[model samples]
Target: MADNYKQYTSCCQAKDWVSLSAYLGFAAAGLAVVWIPIIALAGWCALFYLLVAAAAAGVAACRWWLEVRLVCLGGDRSAIGMLVSSEPPADKSWPGSVDSDFSMNLLPYPALPGIKQADLELTSPYGFLVAEQAGTKQHVGFFTGEKATEKNGVESAILHAEFEGAGVRDVLIAVTVALGLAIAALIACVAIPPPWGLIVAGILALLAFLAALFGTLFGSGDHGAPGDVKGAPTEVHDNDPVTGLGADLLYVYGTWVFDSLHTGWNEIHPIKKCTFVGKWEGAWPADIVDVQHRLDAGFADARDPATVSRQAEDRFTWAIHPLVDGCGEAVDVPAPAQADAGLH
Candidate 1:
């Protein structure tokens, strides 16, 4: 897994260089368009200022897209979680390459279950786990499990990492190209000295400038916090507990909430959403069972007005209390009920 991750990291670094080179090429080409005119009309000092401003804008735009927007909006609500059926292999095969199943749902998409027995070698066993969507064969989020020594009779696994989507790279490339073309057009106007050419170049430059400015300001989403997406670690929790049925169990899970849903400047009232990832078995937690019961009761009493009202009240209280008080812990288990005094 470590080797595989290292390889992937190398690949990403290479890809970054490729992207940087492409952007630089575009910037150079754009500068060539206006180089002659800027030197002839504006003199050396003006030309220098123009070059510096363009470079600064280009750098700022790149950083804004890669570091800010991509980090925040790239996969804010997407994650990978694994549930291993049994202990992993002893050999140094893939760490999380045990007999396991992966399930994931990248917001606005339904939950997808991966194939039970697929080619593991073709898949990423470490770093980011990629699973083929059941029928479509499209790769979804990363998920994997690894062997772990029992700590106080409890076994656990943790996985959290950032992934860049194709969209981020595509947008960056488009902006770079646009800026380049705008410069080229302006140079053509200066060299040719045609009214039509100048008009066209001016339009193109304005459009490109607007695009860069807008993307930098509102590309990611509203309320995009730099620290939130800048290599921030995902939160995870796990523990071992004994159920009333005498079944020992180990559970692991995590949750993530997006900082903002707004994807554009005009967007308002963005849909707020969160994702939950975990693995559990046998008897579920008491709180989960209780919530299910309450929801079911609410459905059953839907025909009665008074019962419906009471159920709504209970549900609201249960749901809002955690939000109001701030749920510091991952999972909260209600205390066990006491037995009746005369029952025994």
Candidate 2:
């Protein structure tokens, strides 16, 4: 898990650097076109300053955005629910089933004051959260789940969304728009003359059209697939016991120990029903004997049976080591009798 996280971080950093480089290069080139001919040496110095400043700001923004996405998607389980509550309400019914369409406001973290309430549209059970916060309906994240939950005494459905490919798509769209505008401005600059202006405008128009075509092609990468990446678990499942285990386990990568861990599987209540939301990756396991074995191993290693019991009392809980993969397969090895002998 540590190695996988490090690799993912490195990949994200490399992507950020590449994006920053491209933006800075274009900005520098454009500034040079405008300022170089008028004031050569001075313009060069100014361009250097601009490049440094722009790069710093751009890279900073990129990193911040990445962090926000990570926190929103990965770190905090309740982030989506919190985000939903922060925004003003809209008159729309929650979809009867996960298969139906729905709309909701997506709010960014309180720290990100610049980010406005994003009006998100859910198309399918697994589609990106479309936000029009920046005056455009853009794909922001994947809709993970929604459940009725309380936040600061207010009752609402807590929505879960993950922003990975959606973030890349956002960057692509921003770059395309910026490039289109730059191309337009360049055409205008060339249109100061007569017959030459007509020729230049026609050529510029052709270039602009080609640029748009290329942008569309480039931006249309696969942003829909959720579980394509390894390590990042996209699926959620309810691993209810078929035998004598009294408590229900909401299993994703590991068994999710929620506050309602003591709730019976057949209980009909709002809290129990909303405690777990979203679709399972595949069919539920015929027997979670392997899962229980793995959990027992983990508990034995902890040397505190009480700690495992305490998890049920907590509002949120995750395993010290995830026992399952993205595909709902157990990955942890069961402890040997000798290892468990001393702990017991």
Candidate 3:
């Protein structure tokens, strides 16, 4: 089971780049429609088909933009809790492959689904871990987890990240447009004559609509669920004695809310949402620097802590809380192999 989860993690990490590729493809498909006529004149009506194709692609681009923006503005990662570890846990057994202090052994580049690299440390009976995510220009937070319900003693987790302001509206509008187009195509096919063009258009629009729906439904709670918090650590209580390691880690299974639902539609969930979970480790004031700088110059500031602390509360207290009651130690993401590694 552990191996299975690690496999899933590795696949998920690689899929980030795959998603980027898919988004670019979507954008390209949209542009292709403009050239459909030239191709059609040569032999086929490729230009007309391309125009329809482009609309679908435009929908995809809009969706990708929504996800990336949210991650940058509101996404975060942290060590939620420990998985089941009995014998001596090997570093290689986990999902992320880390080697040196800065570089990783397996996949080198950061994936697009928000999280970048994971820092795993074995602290006595429990594993102390931290996962550094992709976005840095915005804010960060921690989520929590629940006990295993499968009876295998496995840990279950979830994550909540919010997208705010006009950006959210943009994504919602795109989704509505895509769905509208698909519906139009469907009606045209059913009410009008039977033709390959209409059928193809309907199918493409439907596929795009489903993708958008999956992204949104995957991370949402039932109606009337409470809001969550962001970037707190794993929480554990000594008074509540456990037979073994308690579940305090939160692994974000998938995102529930995407940007499109609230964009042009004037739509927002009834509740303000964010990801919340239990503690993975204790919290302390972590001194943060400009992620753009890669040098070891340990220039630390005093005021930044207070500022970040307040920012943390105001932005995320409703949605999430670190498993640990307080803040964690200051940990820096090392410079990447690319020249702008620190900037990310």
**TM-score per candidate, chains pooled:** 0.28, 0.28, 0.24
lDDT of each: 0.33, 0.30, 0.30
**Once model 3 is optimally superposed onto the true structure by TM-score, how far is the C-alpha of residue 243 displaced, in angstroms?**
45
RMSD of 1: 18.5
Compare candidates 1 and 3 on lDDT and give the better one.
Answer: 1
Candidate 2 per-residue lDDT, tens place, 1-344, comes to 11111111111221222233444566567755765554443322232333333333334444433332221111211211112321111122222111111112122121111221122223221123222122111222122223322232333222233222333334444445444544443444344465664555455445544554454344344232223334333332222223212112221121111111111011111010111222222223433335444544543444465765655542324443333423333458778666665585
Backbone clashes in model 3:
52
Worst 10 residues of 2 by lDDT: 264-273
**Higher-ranked by TM-score: 1 or 3:** 1
Per-residue alpha-carbon lDDT of model 3 for 159-240, expressed as tens digits? 2221222322333454556556654554454444557756765675677566455433421211111111233222222111
| TM-score between candidate 1 and the true structure | 0.28
Q: What overall lDDT, based on C-alpha atoms, would model 1 receive against the true structure?
A: 0.33
Candidate 2 residue pairs in backbone clash: none
- What's the distance in Å from true for residue 333, model 1? 64
Better of 1 and 2 by lDDT: 1
Q: Write the per-residue lDDT of candidate 1 for residues 174-259, one digit (tens) a residue.
A: 46755565656546555655577667666666676666555433323222111222232223223243421222222111222111
Residue 191 deviation, candidate 1, in Å?
Answer: 2.3
